[model samples]
Target chain A: MALDYALLVLAAPASGHSSLTAVRFARALLARGHSLQRVFFLDNGTLTGLAAAVTPQDEHSPLQQWAQLAEEHQTELILCISSALKRGLLDSTEATRHERPGATVHPAFELGGLGLLVEAAQTADRLVTFG
Target chain B: MTAAARKSILVVSRHAHPGSSLPRSALDTALAAAAFDQPVALLFQGEGVLQLLSEQDSRAAGVRNLRKVLDSLPLYEIETLHVDAAAAAAFGLDRDALPAGAEWLDAAGIRALLARHDHVLGF
Candidate 1:
């Protein structure tokens, strides 16, 4: 069966294995013909969308990897609005609204409300949260 | 959505406060689901039972007090609060030290609770 899965990312890119594991799981599931409904980032997981994150030359950039995955899979990448704001992961509109210096959110991701996660939980065949 | 139409969501909080913020997020998720008209249940298991201890002050620590959030669960219509009996006992918490209205569950009861839910989000 081609199950539709929604992933909740709760771990930061550099903190633990959850983010990388989620990326790998997404790739694997998509390859198996499963549909990824959305990838919702919460808590420190919102840090994965940092626009200015610099990766070591020897290491793969999780930010770019996530961006590429969303682009290729047409997957919705959402960051929790409160969590993003707390971590300063803002989009252009949010930055302007808050009169911040600049937007730090990447183009691939959008800031969203908790309602989106609630909806995803209701609609997706499976909701997997990685933290 | 009506009661029958909504998905039954179980938010499993398994961590202690002050050490990690995930416990707060788990409660937030439950409240959000309840606000969205989904059937929501919150379970405090493992080290998560530590959150049930009354009067934890985090004002000086500069972090949001999770008890404030937990106290608000009923206002959101999330009355299905659960606590693992073993976890609570392991933490040496008397029943009075915990909040009122929480149903204490044994291991099998917890298993049944998970089985009945449409979705389980663990933290």
Candidate 2:
């Protein structure tokens, strides 16, 4: 039977291939008919939502693939609000309040609290993290 | 937070205090799981064992005292704590010098323990 999977991506883009591998794992699970409950980004993983990141040609950018996965499969992409704010990743609403430049987090990702993590932990059959 | 659905979780904390907030955050996560009655085990490896040193004084550095939080783990129903033996030794920490309750685990022991958990979270 197909199981619910929660993929928690915790590595920064510069830190080796963890984030890329996470995206690949997500794709493989989806291909095999597993249900992706959500992809929760924490710490440096939130950088994946930074819209201004430009990947050089000949390189595979999992950040872009994460956005694409959300678009195609409607997967929930959540970044911890506290971690995001601390890292200076501000959405438009937060930008207006903080008076900083608006952040690059794509519209496909939502800034949420750690409570969502608890929910995922409670409901998902499997919780996998890559960092 | 009913007790019936608690998952078996292993939390591997890999950083130090006064530099990274992850150790405290990992504690909070463990506390949350404990509050929900999840069976949780905490393992301190790498620089994470530094949080367990006796003279930490993290508060003077403007960070919350992770050592204090760790002391309260039992109150939160989280009593299983482990320290990586090799990591501790590499950091020049003697097993007897650690806090009163944490057990020691070697690399193989840590791996075997992790294999038994339904979920493993690293910091």
Candidate 3:
């Protein structure tokens, strides 16, 4: 039987392979027919939601890959609201609320509270963390 | 959710305080789980035991005092706190040196705690 999976990503793409590993793992599991309940970004992991981040032409962009995964698979990509705000990542709603100059959150992701992470823990068959 | 439907979560914090963000993140996760009524357990291993130090002054580090968060554990109903005995001793911390209400676990006890939870998050 296919298991329901939720991922907690704590490593930033710039610092380590943990975020990339999580993306690949997500793809692999989804390919095997497992249901991805959500991918919650926390701490530095919220950096993945930077739509303005420009990747070098030669490198594989984990950012693009993540966005594509959400576009293709209809996956829920959520950034921890507290972590995201602290890291200066804002969606349009958050930007307006916080009076920020602009929003940096990618369209594929939504800013949510830690309660969503708790909900995932309670509901998902597997809760995985990468940091 | 029914009792059987509620998944138990184990957060294994394995980083040191002051230098890294993982320790705080791990505790936030544990608190969030507890807030949602999920049975949550927190395990401090490796350098993570340093976070339980009662005398840490966050002002010096320019970070929020994690001791404050530790103190709020009871309020969140997250009572199951485990500290690796060897890790604490390695850092020269005695029982009274850290926060109260934390249970000391040996290697085997750590293994059992990992096995008891439905999901384990290592930070």
Candidate 4:
């Protein structure tokens, strides 16, 4: 039977290794013919979708890769807005609220709440998390 | 009802035996979810490999053997069990040393397996 998958990427780029691990897992999951319904970013994982950072030439940027994946796969990338805000990640609305210079939200991502997490759990055939 | 329609949870905990409150919390959550007839799968990762070691004595920690609790998982019908391959290797644990029926998975495999469950709770 076909399965709809919800993946939680919970590790930050600054964290040891979870971000890369999550990307590899997400790629492999799609390759194996599973359906990815949503990709919810929480805690440090939200950093994977930040749009303002400039990546050094030698480093692999998770944000760019995830953005491309979202566009190609049409996966809903949800950034936990509360967690992002607390961590200093601001969307256009938030950037306006705080009068920040640049918007942190990426085009491929949407600011959301815990309701997205609950919805992913309640709706997906499977919920997988990488942290 | 479809499995997707029912409430189910998969817990991935990678702490040692008699380790900390985290593993216990994961177990408690799994047990509670199972009690509600929600299918639960407990996947052990990292140091959580120690959890499957037989003859655990939690009395030193003023606790009961967690293995004992895990053994009763079948009674709750929470039978999907998984252990991380790298964790077992890190601890120098042989495959045969784990609980008889638990599936051993590599990192990538574990990732895919997790994607096959309804909900994932980790500690």
* Per-residue C-alpha lDDT of model 3 across residues A2-118, encoded as one tens digit per residue: 999999999997776788899999999999999897999998899999988888898778899999999989989999998899999998888899899988988999999999988
Report the C-alpha displacement of residue A50, candidate 2, in angstroms: 1.4
How far out, in Å, is residue A13 in model 1? 0.6
Over 4 Å off, model 2: B18-21, B35-37, B58-64, B106-112
Clashing pairs in 1: none
Sorting all predicted structures by TM-score, with the top scorer first, yields 3, 1, 2, 4
DockQ-based ranking: 3, 1, 2, 4
Interface RMSD of 1: 1.3
Tell me how far the alpha carbon of residue A100 in candidate 4 is from the true structure, in angstroms, after superposition: 3.2
Best candidate, DockQ: 3
lDDT tens readout by residue for model 1, B18-78 = 7897887888788888878788898999999999888799888888888777777788887
- The C-alpha stretches of model 4 lying farther than 4 A from their native spots are B1-4, B10-118
Candidate 3 reaches a DockQ of 0.85
lDDT score, candidate 1, position A123: 82
Higher-ranked by DockQ: 1 or 3: 3
TM-score of each: 0.95, 0.85, 0.97, 0.57
Off by over 4 Å in 1: B1-5
Backbone clashes in model 2, listed as residue pairs: none
